[model samples]
Target: MDAALFAKSLLLGLAIAAPLGPIGALCINRTLERGILAGLAGGLGTALADGVYASLAAIGFAAFSDALARIDMPLRLLGGAFMLWLGVREMRPAPPRAPAPVRPRDLLGTTASTFLLTITNPMTILAFAALFAGLGLAATSSNADAALVVAGVFTGSMLWWCCLSGGVALARHRLPPAFARWVARLSGAILIAFGLAALLTALA
Candidate 1:
């Protein structure tokens, strides 16, 4: 694997994944409610999904990419709806009762949910396909090179998630319980707004 190519791929993957979309929002919420490790687990799940798509693109799976492009709108609509639902669920008033303790199982659940959510969005695959083609990366026939590209993608994604989760966690202590609750509400609202924007863009 060429070092320059690997670096380029890693940078591109990080740029694409750094956006604070629904998955990021969920990760942040989990980190705030549970801990940074839980959020990192969720981010790893997303990175795995991205690597899968990157592999598909690197292999020049034109049929698969074409199929994803064909159904892109519907997929975006579904994703947008799901994001909206998640935002609303997050924003709901917390009961006066004490919050439940974070469990190991909860980390696994968060990871699985984000992984499934990301995998179902075929647009991600198409985006990868286009990006690989544009960068002349689709012509890579060597398995080693392909593996390196995939690894780069995973590294880039993990870096973004780590930064995001860490940044959020750092601010966790500065705020009181009331402020934290308000932050949660604001985050939920921002997620909903992004969902609406995505839905509108798709419809348009």
Candidate 2:
């Protein structure tokens, strides 16, 4: 086990996941509306997607990489559309209610939705490729090293999500319902803006 390699990968994952993008907003909203577990589930989905992208980048599979690149525009469009739908849904007014208990089905659906959202972003693969190359893990890493990198990335991403969700959950327990509602609306607006940006970029 290359401890240094693992450590670097872990930090890389944390850095990549730390940005509060649309995905982060979704997770935070879910945390406030559902619970910590639901938010963590969403994070797990994103972590898994990151792991998949990392593996694909590390393996240097030319065919797979090329295919992903070829479909980049379409993927972006789909992602943008999905984000818009989600944003509108989030912005919809809901009756004041207690946080729902996390059920297996709910977790599964949340995880699947987040995973799809993350995976659809074609730039994720490019980002992983660029980062791996920057870190000197591009051409020379062995199979074991690649595996470790994937594991480290997954673990690190999950760690960030866990911390974020926990903190938000604590606030959820204390904050008034109006605060949550306002936050949800803000998150939805952010998501809508991001979706518009993505769509325009794809079209351009």
Candidate 3:
């Protein structure tokens, strides 16, 4: 793998993952509710999902790609519905105390949930495919290069999650219960909006 190519991939991956979207919001919420480890696990899950999609794109599996494309809209609809449900759940009233402290099981659950959510988005795969094709990444023709690209993606994702979690944590104490509730509601609303937009695009 060329050093320049690896650096380029790393930068591009970071650029793509830095956006604060549904996943980022979820990571921040988890970090505040649980801890930094929980958020990191969630970020790792998303990064792994991205790597999987990238690998698939690098291999140029046409049949699988076409199948994913065919079902992308349905998948997007399902994702949107799930996000809406999550938003509604977040908007509900809660008790006046923090929930249980973070545990190993909590970490595992958080990681798995985020991983499943990220991986099930067929649009992500298509996005990776288009990016790989546009960047001529497949021309590298080396598993090591592919691995490096995956590492870059993982690093970039982790960086974003860490920054978000840290930033949220910094202000967590200052925010009262009421403020936290509003924050949750606002984040949930944004997530729902993104989901709706994605659904509309898929339908169109």
lDDT of each: 0.73, 0.82, 0.69
How do the residues 20-89 of candidate 2 rate in per-residue lDDT, one tens digit apiece?
9878988988888888999999999999988887787667755556878798899889988988888898
By lDDT, the better pick of 1 and 2 is: 2
Among the numbered candidates, top lDDT falls to 2
How many pairs of residues collide in each model?
A: 0, 0, 0
Q: What value of lDDT does candidate 3 attain over all alpha carbons?
A: 0.69
Candidate maximizing TM-score: 2
Residue 82 in candidate 1 has what lDDT? 67
The alpha-carbon root-mean-square deviation between model 1 and the true structure, to one decimal in Å, is 3.0
Q: Give per-residue CA lDDT, model 1, range 1-204, as digits (tens).
A: 489778867875786578776677777777777668877888988988888877876666675578677877777787667667767877874632223566878778887877876775544555666676777667777888888888888888888999988987788776566754665677678657756765886899
TM-score of each: 0.81, 0.92, 0.82
Ten consecutive residues with minimal summed lDDT in candidate 3? Answer: 91-100
Per-residue accuracy of model 3 over 48-106 as CA lDDT, tens digit each: 77777666655554654676778788888877776777667656635445535678887
